[model samples]
Structure formats: C-alpha cells, structure tokens
Target: MKEKVLILNIGRCAWGRCIFCGYSRENYPEPNLLRMKVDLDRKLVGFEGDTLKIFGSGSFLDDKQFPREFRRYLVEKCKKKGIKHLTIESRPEFITEDTLLDFDGIDLTVAIGLEVADNDILKKLGKGMTVEDYTRAADIIHSKGFKVRTYLLVNPPFVDDIKESLDRSVSFALQHSDSIVLINLLPHANAPLFDLWVEGKWKPLTREKFFEITRPYANNPKIELDVETFRFVPRFPPEKRANLEGVSSEILNHPHFRVWQEYLCDWYEKPKDKTIALFLPCSAKKPYSKSKTHTLIYKTIKTLPIFKNIHRLVISTPGVVPFEFNDFYPFNAYEWDERLETPEIKKEYIKVTKKRIFDYLKHHKYDHYFCFFKYSAESYIALQEACNELGVSCTNCLSRETYEALKEEKGNPLFKEEALKELREVLSKVKQKGT
Candidate 1:
C-alpha cells in the first residue's frame, strides 16, 4: 500500500478481555514486550514511511506493556523519520495529558473502543469504562490538538436485531468522535457474543441487514467501515505473518468488498447451473483455495470430473457463499477466535445453519449434495442432521459412496507427508531467525 502503513502488534491488551476482542489471546499473546520491541526493530530496518501507527494490542501509554524508555525511543525514532501523522490504539482512561504531551509536534490520533453508547452493551462487553468516560477522553485528546477515533461493533450479543444496534452505535459515535470504525463481530473463543450464539441467542447479521442499518451514515466521510472485516481472519503463524510488520502486498491490496450499499443491491450473483452442490467451511486464511485444509480436500476429490461445475458454497457467519464469491469481501476476510469450538456451540450453529441451508436449497436443484470440510464445518454437521429430519439426503466425506470415491486417480499418495515437511521447514526458518 502506498499509504506506508505499519500495523504493529506489541503484546497482549492490558485491560484483559473485551468480550468482543480476541487480540490478547489470538494475536500477540502474553509476549515479552521487550523481545517484541527487538523483533520490531529488526523489521523496521527499511521502514521509509512518513505516517506511523503503533497498534500493538496494549495501550501505548501503559507503562508496563510499553516501557517508558521504549516508548520514548519510538517517539524519537518516529521524529527522526520525519513522520507526519502518528496514531496509537489505547483506552480512553489512558488518554492522559501527560501521554498526549509526548506527541506534541506529530499529528497524533488516539483510537479507542467505545463499541457503542448504550450502557447495557458496554456492560455486556465488559468495557469497564463508560461512554461518558470516552467522551471526556476524546475531549482531552482534542484539547491537546490531537484526533480521536472510536470503534463500534455492528452485531453485538443479546441484540435480537442488528439494525437497531447499528443505528444506535453510529448515531452516538458520529456526534462524539473525529472518525468512526464500524467493526463487525467475528465471534470465537469464549467471546460473550459467541456464548450467546451457542444458546441460540444471537444470529450473525446478514450483509443486507447490516448495510440497511448503516445506510444512513454511508455518505458521512468521517465514518469508515472496512467491509473486509466480515471475512477477516487473523492468521499470524510465522510463515503467514512475514517481517513486513505482518503486512503484505496481497493483504495491502486486497479488495474492499462491500455487502450493502444503499445504491447497490446486486452484491451476490447466483449460479444459473445447479449441477451438484458441494459445501465447505471457511478456513483461517483468505482465498480458501490456498488454505491447507482446502488443499487436502481438493486433492481427495480431484479425480472425479463428474463433480466439476458443482455449486461450491462456503458456509460462513455471513451465510452460504458460492465459490464465485469466496474471494469477495465477506467470503474469507473475517477474524474469529479459536476457543469458541465447544460442543454446545456447535449445536446452536447447526440449528441456525439448517435454516439458511434449507433456504438456499429451495432455489437450486442439484442431483446430489456433498460436503468435505474440516472441523471448522460445525454447521455442516447440523446441515446433515437437518436434512435427515426432513428425510433429504446430503452426502459427506464420511458417507460410504463419498469415501470410496475419495482416492483421486492422479493424486499423490504422500501429499500429507509432503505438506508436513513444508510446515517443518518454515518452522525451522522462523526458529533460526529468532536466534
């Protein structure tokens, strides 16, 4: 990206868990901030950007997470680099005058998570701070000649409907902050929302519903809603996350897929040929084709040309997505936590998934239905059970016919071993670099 953005993840977020965020557990973990600084120093060898963003999980002002000496060094480093705008993610409580004073000359901006103005939602998300506290912090930052950016969630837990919450979140944010970032929920781990999902309390917001709710604020320039969050996944394993501040050309240049625009409604184009239906769960990476899970599945079924032109759909939080739409905005751009895979949660997902899958099946006529997905396909199991209840047949990898047909005529017998070899090689390279 010409913008020269430096997205850094220092360590775990200081305030512990935010019910909605998995940054602490998913990204950096309880990392040695000192070692993180050293690694960052190594990666910044050729950073020639004028704009700087210090976005590790913790509050930049938190002395414990980011030592005073290290913070001072970063400030001096940015100053020496001639940085124009400097921004960091922190809590409203940490927006002290003393901290703002550190960015006296640089264009400073403090981004905070004021998920919504509603007191109930704040309490539910475990945001110990309140909306009033955020406003005061924003005012303090503004007084210091700096900017304040606020983040709000789209579909939070306990909200029966997403439109009401989106409107409420946008209305309050537009009035109190310089910019607003609308974050869509990517529930996983023991995320409070995901907990609700397990009990059939909360449903993933459809793209149409999400856009319809946020349409009133669409024209507002200060409001920035990056649609990629719908399918955003945080894959930071060494080989996936490079030395480029965890940034890459594909990541930087990935298209911003919008689900809902007041002016455009034709986001999903249907497949005319209903040949054979094949469903799979989304992987932790974008472009599902590149994911190891998908690689294995494809290799297992490639010999059967008869399944070609099958209607391939990836069942995700956004609902059923055709393979043609896999690379689009919400297809693979989501970041869900890994801890949310309990047996209880799968039951809830299956119950809801069956409804969407049935709705999809009504329009498309397929000679046969098949599924081949990893454990990620919790909903697929539900789909099978749902079909059974309705006395409809859905073939899966475990099915006798499907298993018999799994061996591809030209497939490599040692594909799994080869894949593991590549994995070890990458791990060794990372280990050597750390030394």
Candidate 2:
C-alpha cells in the first residue's frame, strides 16, 4: 500500500521565538491570511494524496494565519478533492475547544510541537508553551474526536544524557499522543540557538546520534522518525549559512524521511577524499581555541606547511569535532574531566568516545591519520582501539621517550620541546609527501 502524503506549506508561524527555530525570522510583518489562501489554492489544485499535511509555519487553526472563513474554505476544498485525512500543525496555545469545533465534520489529526517532556528543558528551549498547555490541547483534540500527533527532538539542547532524555520524552509523549514525530535538533542561522552554537553553548545532534536515539522507537507504528530535517532545505543567503536549513522544516515534513535523509547527508556528511587528518585531543576549556594547550598546539601546527592542507579534528567527549566546529555547542561547552569522575563515568566516557571514533572512521576517508595526545589519555586509547579494530594505522606525533617522560605528569606535554620536535618531524613528512 503506497501511503501517499501531500505536504503543503502555508503561512509563516507566529510565536517564533522558540530558541531553536528560525521560522520567526521569516515571519515578517505581512498579510499572511491573504498570502496563505493563495499558497493553499495553488498547492491544492488537482491534489492527489490520501493524507494532506497543512503547515502554516505556526498554528493552521490560528485565525490570524488562517482565518475562520479560510478554514471553512479549506474544508470544502479538501472535501471536494476527496482528501481522506488532514494533518495540520498548531501551537498548544492556539488549539482550543472552539478552534477544533470550527472543523467539525473533517477527519483531522492535530500535530503539536512538544519538543521535550521535561518542563525545565522546554523552558530552556523557549518553547513558550508548557506540558500543561500541550496536554490541554491534546485533551481538546481528543474530545473533538481528532487524532493527536506530538513532536519530539532527540537529544535536545541542555539535555545531559541523549539516550535517557529521549527515552523519557518518547515514553511521556506516547501516553498522550496518538502518534509521535521524532527529529534531531538542527541548528539554523537567525535562530537564537544558532547564536548559542556560535558561542559554544549548544550543538545539534549528528545523524548517527539521531539514529541511535530513535532506533528504540523504530518498530513502534505510532512513532514517525522525521528524516525530513535532512531534506527540502529552505534556501538562505550564502553569507548567512552555507547549507543547513531551519528546524521547522523537520516539523513540516515529518513523514518524508528520504528527503530529510538526503538533506542531512548534504549538511553533515564529511568529504571522503581528504588526504590528511590530524586528530587532536579534547580540551578542558570550552572551544579548544580558548584553552592554553590547544592554543599552543594550533600556534605550533600553523607554522607547518601541511597544516593548511590537513583536516583538523578534535577527539572530544561528545565526538569527533571538525576543528571548524570547535566553537560549536557541546564541543565547546562540555566540562567533563575523567580525572575527577567515578570509574563508571570514566568507563562510559571511553565507551562513548570509542564508538564515536568508529562512527567517524566509517563515514570519513583520509589517506593519513596523525594523532597528538598524551600517550596515556583515554581519547588516545579509544582512537587506537578503533583504528586497530578497523585495521587502520595512526601515527603518534609523540616519541616513545617523550611519552615515557610525561606519562604521569599533569602539565601540558604537547608544549614540551620534545613533543614539538616530534610534531614538526611528522608533519614535515606529510608536507614532503604532498609535494
């Protein structure tokens, strides 16, 4: 059975201040109701799908975006087109008993953005609506004999454990929603979250992380993994953002996972033909650039000819961060120190780091892998184990004598003359090879 789905974008959303959303930036002062009707009519012409998803960038039920007369008009239009079911988006605040009452005869599924179940996390996201609001809307939707679909972000910002928080959120949303839509948070320009990303206060989940988080719910029929964040990429000026689109696109195209998958690949996929990769250890400071050790490393490395050609990556707590993203989110923000944590914590860190290394290796292609780390560091062990497992050899930029000397020290070993000399020699070889 080919489940035909037609998704139409209408008016711009209201209450656009959700820290993670970029829609509000596009929702300028305009006569949305008039524009929405024109957009709707154009899309609905000769409509041929079992399910029609009407997205107004906000609440489709809101009169400001879609007026009462337009609601009646849409109902007639859908009925005439023999549209079997209509899925429309709304904010919890805009969904009321009276609002649902307006579309009385239609088979409707009302979708609401309940990004996370935790109220504190919701507040941090600047979602504006509370759990109570969503539940209240869901109750009204149910009372009106409509289906409730809820949206959840896997590993949302400000969350501690990606898997745990997603588990809790999915569990909670399932109880209230007839269906659930899951998407990884995607950072976009103009959103408040983008600013956080720039400042190293937040980061969006990678495709691998998203898959891992949503895998538990894949078998559940009620759960819909919104792979659309990866597709139908909204265009933005090149100067603003190169490829990434808004988070709202994920919400709008939840069922079109293929489209989303392609889009995500375009945004996050690494260039596979790179000739050299330098895997540096994570820093204690937020944004490795701010750390004294990393600062010295960069300063020393930049003097080498190969530095201009090699891909710079950080072996960090969150995962492998391309040096360009060192200033973004968890890469820049996390303060986890294995030295002060419990054994279990340390074990988990090693496991996660190793898994990330494997994931990175699986996706990225590099002719040479050079690592600069304290010989005894957990990151080094993890990367070494991954390389060994994959039959890939990685050269260490620290000599055996230098590693033995500082194997027990707390100071920055990379700053030492021996370490610097080894780094220079190894990079010199790379430069020579490139020539």
Candidate 3:
C-alpha cells in the first residue's frame, strides 16, 4: 500500500476574530511566509504514495495571488507521477464557477471549510460567507465534475443550541455536497480564542463532551463526517503530547475514562460466543488524528473470531470511513459537542445513543448489541430498552467483572507494589484526618 502524502498549509484565516477560534491569531505565520510551492514540489518528487493531497493552512483559494505557475506545476507534476487522487481546500467565498474551470482536466478533489450552515452562527464565527455561498460553491465544483467536500465545525462559539446547529449544518451539507467532514473544535494557544481561556473567559470541552456533541453527525449516511481533533493526550507512554496543551485533570477522571479502561480490559475478557453487533455512535474525535484506540480496535477485531459474526452499524455524517468493519449504516444527528467532559455532555451522549438504538431496532432487529466504548453507552441502553420493548437480550462486555479480570491480567509486580504504596498513603491520610 502506498503511503498518503499530505501537503498542508495553515491558511491565514479570513475570519480571524471568531470567539471560539484558537487558530485565528493575527501574527501567526502565513503560508506565504514559507517556501510553500517549492517545499510541496520537493515533497511530491520523493513521495511514492498513491495519493498526493495538497492541503494545509489557509484556504487554497485564499491565496489569490499564488502564481498560476505554481498551480500548473502541481497539476503537471501530479499527472507525471500518476498520483491517483489530488486534494485541496478552500473557503466558500474563494470558490466560483471560474475558479472551478481553472483546474480543467486535473484529477482532484476540492474541499471547502464552511463550518456551519446557519447564517447567524456564520456571522457569529466571523465566517465571511453564507449558506447560499456554500451551496453555490458546491454546485460550481460539482458542475466541473470534481468531487466536492465540505468541512463542518460542530458546536461553534456563541451557539447555545449545539444540536440544532449540527442538524442544520448536516442538512445543508447533505443537500449540497458529495461528502462532508465533521471536525470538533479544540482550543489551542495560537488561536484568538485561547486568550479567552487564559483570561478565564472560556472553558474548553472535555473529550467525553466533544464525543456527545458530535454523536449526531457521526450517524449520518448521506454525507461522510470525518473526525479531526487538535487535542492529543497520550493514553500510554512513548506517545508524546502533540503541539496542543494539556487537558484538565477532571476530564482525565471523567466517567468515560472507564471506557478506555474497559477497552484495555478486553484483553482479559473471555470472548463471548454470542453474535455481537458493534454499534459506533458518531464521534467528533477522529482516531486518525489522535489516539491508538482505532488501531487497537482494528487489531482486537482481527484477533477475535467474534468479529466474524459481528454486524457493525455506525450512525454518522457522510465523508470519512468510520471503521474497517464490514457492515456500516450511517445516519445524521441533531448536534455535536466539541468539549470532552460535563454532565450536560453525558446527558446528550445518552440521548443520542437512545436515538440510534431506536432507529436500529425499528429497521433491523439484532440478537445482542455490544458497544466497544463507554461513549456508546447511550446506544447500549437504547438497545437494552429496545430489548425490553421487544423482549430481546442485550449485554455489554465492559461490565464490573471485565474490569476485575483486566486488573488481574495486568499483573506487573511493579504496578502491584505501586498500588500497595498508594493504598498505604490513602490510609495514612485518613488516620491523620481523624487524629
């Protein structure tokens, strides 16, 4: 398999003042500041990948002054290399009928980061274009016979109703484009919005909260929803933190932590013989962008013969492939939260899962539905409820027994000694408090 090559440019953001935007700082280095075209060409020459993706900072269309020579160079070089797919990004305002014509015969995919479809939210985020602009841009791109992709940013700032905003965005994308990318916002120090956090004016969403918010988009079928995140907290050693800052300790201890713990626990759990139906709710977090969890799932699935009998059904936005599982059914949800932790986030998580289960049962009934992660608990509960409604049996692998079994399997003598030390410290604290 040829490795994928990505030519990224963080564009000089046109809407540099959106309240929730952390990548909109005025002094951030522009693509024009670097030897962009030369670097891209150099990278392309050595890359042996089947796909050459020209992407990164600022919109491809934002650099209106980029020499036509550079564009021509990219096309001719890609054609010569026999690159299978060429991709680029642009803002809605930068796309027009004439702009589409410029690419002519180059085999490529053009994507625009529209973020949201609501005009009010667009203005709130300082997105320069409206829904109509995006629609028109999609029409123009499609008319040129190029694949059109739209990027939707769920749970943007100033948007009180997260679900409504996501529904509207997904609806718009489904109606307009061939594919949609759903990205959850992460606050970074470089964005204009970071100061809001520094000034205690804003609070970033936890991973759990973000998953709950993006659940709806994850389920959509009409368009693909690709989950990308800026947050990178390592689940294990040898995984260094990405350029993003550390997440809160509270988020670290959140209930969903058990989900990952349970996943690690799966190694010890005796593989059940029942027909397992894997239900993945839409998540704002993309495994490709963040953790090894996706890879772990793929590996686990391969090792367990149970997966052969498993029916995987994912409900999410259209665009990115959800998983390597054989059976997938996608659906759209009302909202996506980009934050990771909170009670409200948990509530929404439960609600979306319930909706998915209801939809699944109504169409196709299953023997038993097993959720791999805690994020899918809502779906699990819904399945339980559906079972109750129809008197069927449903169970999860991440029960208390599974956790206990996992602890026994991870029998590192050092780990046991550390636990004993921690226990002594805790008892000492209790004795001191009583005294």
Candidate 4:
C-alpha cells in the first residue's frame, strides 16, 4: 500500500543552536498562529493520508515553540483528516510522558534527534543533549509503546576521518532506533557549522565516502535506513555535491577501515621485551607524532637511550592508534576532541579507553608503562582508571617544564583549509601505490 504523507509547517525552533543548522534554512518566517485554528481546519478539511508529518520548524510538543492549542488542534485535525498515524519533529527533551498523551489515539512515531551516539561529536555540534539522555528518552518512548524514529546526523563536524565517522554513526543508530534516518548536513551561509568549515575545522562527508559506509548495511536484516530523511531540513542538492566516483578499493579492505578488529590486534612489530611505553593523550594536531606535545615527549625520551624499549601509543576515542601508524590513513588525516570537558562525555571516554588500554597491555608485556600526559585528567582519566583496574601502575613521567613547553608551540595542525583536502590527498596517494 502506498503511504500518503502530509507535511504541515506548524514556527522557529525554540532551542536552535545546533551547529549545523542554518537559521534561515531550517526554521523561520514565523507563521501567524492567530489563524492556526481556521487555517489547519481548512488544510485538513478533506485530507486523507496514512501519516501526518507536522513541522513547527521546532519541537511540535514544545508549548513555548508551538502553542498548546495548536498541538491539540493538530491531533484533532489529523483525526478529522482520517489520518491513521502521525509523526512529528522534536528534540529529545520534548519527547515526554505528557507529550505522548496529546496524540494518544493516533499511532505516534516521534522523530527525535539521535544525532550521533558519540558525545564528543554532540558537544562539537552544540547538540546540548548527551547519549545517556538520548538512551533514557528512547527507553521512555519505547516503554510508552510509541514508535521510535531517530534522525542521525551524517558528516557531523570535528572529525577528519569522514568514512570512520559515518560507519560509527550508522552502527550506533541501527542498535538504538527502529527506523534509521540519515540526514546529510548541507552547509549554508549562516549555518553555525559554516564558520568552522571556513576555518578548515569541520568538513562534510563526501558522496563517495557516504556510499562506502552504506554498502555494508545494504542487506542487513535489521531496521530500514532512510536516505530521504531530511523532509523538512535542507539536503545537499545535486549541483552542490562533490564528485562521488573512483574511491580506492584497497581502502575498503585496509585494516584502518576495519577499525573494530584493527584496534584489537594481538601482535605488532614493536619490540615488547622490557619495553618502556609512553602513553600520551590525543592532540588537536593531525598526526600526534607531529604535535608539539609529542615532539617534546620524544625529545625528553630520547635523552635516555638506556631505556631501550620505547613504545608510543596515543590514547584516542577511536581506540588505541599506534604512534608509528599515526600517519597512516584515518589517524593521519582525522581530527578529535579539542577542549572536551563534559562529565557525561567523560564516562564514555573511560569505557573505550579501558578496552583499548587493556587490549594493549594484554598482548604485550612492557617493563614499565609511563604515562607522560601533563594535560587535564579528562584526556587521560580513562587510562588511569583502566591501569588501576588491570592491576597495572602507570608512572606520570613528564615534568611541568615539558608540559608548559608543549603548549607554547601548539597550533591548529589538523585544520585542512579546504573541503576534503586530507581525505583526497590520502586517498590519491594510497590509490596510486595500489594499496
């Protein structure tokens, strides 16, 4: 049966600081709610559809954004229109118990922003809510027997590794929501993310990378994923798109692309016999090896050659990426946390850091594990907790002088200045070598 859908514009978003959203593009031109009663009644006079998608340009349930009478009228109009079901655009916070009751008779499918599962990305995007918050909202939604529909943000900012970011996004959404909606971020003149884009900080994922990430989920016996997810929001139209052809196949098979297992490898070429390990926090620098903090750490470590086994690995959110392989693929070209301070995000940092740290220790026996991170504990708090849990003690080796010197020479090394420069450069080189 063909599903007839009705999209009704109900005002500007009440909470509209989402970094990717454009004020004029996503929400605006306040509709005269004075005529809302007569207008909606006329619009739905003889309307017949399976679904009624209401857009307030904001949260449909937020009374401040959409008046209570308008919301109640929506349900009344849908019922009068003979609509069997209704779907509405709302942020996570608006999906409350009382909100659900407002549309009790209709089969309600609440579309909430499960934007991205990673809290770090959420922080960068100005998405106020946390993953824990989303989980609670999702549970509340499901517990009430209301259908759950999630809107996932594609090509969200703060990561140079676009492909990895997409894969993580899809995987997270599939496990959480019933129907997955991939909303591709289209940058506009006044978009919050545009400022970051021009500064060479935030880059949208290309069409080529998007296809690569979607390929694996094609035949999965899970929930249906939607491409036309941005019904009310702006999309990356054809003319504005990057060329989506000729991505390297070797990249598809590379270990870096397969992050889950690549991160869990039991053995590498690094000498493990009585080795001295330098555990460092992630940097804003593209490759941690090139970062001033890392450079200083190397200089300090090299002074003592007698400490033979010098193994360096970065403590990053994408698991433990080896220091030597830092310049390879994603690690070399990607970006991560700049000033992460949320306690909510901190809990997540500990979970991933614990797994990668333990995996590193389990495979190799280091004579001494020296954590030289002089940054805030938020950066390496996971590593500390992980080491303690594993009955392993990591020494804090870097002195205050080294820490101060590292900060003095820091710069925005990861910023690419143009869209997809690092991704294209890395891909072109890798493709030429036939890897």
Cα lDDT tens digits for candidate 4, 118-224: 88878878888898888777787787888777787667777666667767877777666777676666555356575554355654444445555566666765544
lDDT of 4 at 398: 45
TM-score of each candidate structure, all chains considered together: 0.59, 0.57, 0.50, 0.49
> Which has the better lDDT: candidate 2, or candidate 3?
2
Report lDDT (Cα) of residue 145, candidate 4: 84
TM-score (C-alpha, index-matched) for candidate 4: 0.49
Candidates 1 and 4, the one with greater lDDT = 1
Per-model root-mean-square deviation over C-alphas: 14.4, 12.2, 15.7, 19.5
Clash count for candidate 4 is: 1
Candidate order, lDDT descending? 2, 1, 4, 3
Clashing residue pairs in candidate 2 are 13-57, 202-329, 227-260, 230-260, 230-263, 230-264, 231-260, 287-332
Q: Mind giving the per-residue lDDT tens digits that candidate 3 earns over 1-435?
A: 474646454446664565555444534444452476677666766677667666555566554434455666667777777776777877767777666656766766788878888888788667777888888888878888888888887656767777787887787687777778777665554454544433444445544566687776666664564434544221221121122212333332332232222222221121233234555444444432132433444444544434555555443322112244212111121123435446664555445445434544554444555444332344445546655776555544344444344456654221233333432232222221112
TM-score of 1: 0.59
Candidates 1 and 3 compared by lDDT, better number: 1
lDDT, candidates in the order shown: 0.61, 0.72, 0.52, 0.60
TM-score-superior candidate, 1 or 3: 1
Model 3, residue 189: distance off in Å is 2.2
Q: After superposition, which runs of candidate 4 have C-alpha atoms over 4 Å from their true positions?
A: 1-10, 23-32, 220-435
User: Positional deviation of 203 in candidate 4, in angstroms?
Assistant: 3.2
